[model samples]
Target: MKRTDIDANVLIAAFQGEGEVCQRALRVLDDPDRKFVVSDYLRLEVLPKPTFHKKREEIEFMQAVFERAEHLDTSPTLTGRAYYGLEI
Candidate 1:
């Protein structure tokens, strides 16, 4: 099986439901050939705002993904390299 990391946009799209983009996002998540990988950064990116606003359904959706997917820690060095293209 291939391990795939889902971006915050994709997770948001999936939670949103309906439309072509949502359909596509669901397809990627539902693919049995792939294993989902999630990072602490992803949780921070998607969870905090919804949680603060009390978007219960959205929070639940994000929580479900975090619970089921393989968790990976986000390091400062890796984040700098990934986001800013800096060697850290």
Candidate 2:
């Protein structure tokens, strides 16, 4: 599907360099075949906070990536509750 499901932390660390995990993810993302899969849920997870004060440009770039990537339906229900209208 030319898609990869990446964790929110990886995305955050790639730009902010908060941990080694982020460094590794950036290396993995260098492969031309990889594309991060996105959804409203992922957006909800990552886009809420500013990682730093002056990185709006970086944030906007990341937002553009999420905006253009393939989207997926989130888990329909978690435990017994529906999340994003999809069953977990």
Q: List TM-scores for all candidates, in order.
A: 0.78, 0.62
How big is the positional error of residue 52 in model 1, measured in Å on the Cα after superposition?
A: 1.3
Tens digits of per-residue lDDT for model 1 on 1-88? 9999989998889988679999999888889898899986787688767776778889888888788799887797866554452111
Residues 1-88, candidate 2, lDDT per residue (tens digit)? Answer: 3678877777777776756776786886666788778776776566545533445766685687687577887665542252333321
Cα shift from native, residue 28, model 2 (Å): 2.3
- Which residue runs of candidate 2 sit more than 4 Å off their true CA positions? 18-20, 51-55, 74-88
lDDT of each: 0.81, 0.65
Global local distance difference test of model 1:
0.81
Kindly report which residue stretches of model 1 are placed more than 4 angstroms away from their true locations once superposed: 75-88
TM-score of 1: 0.78
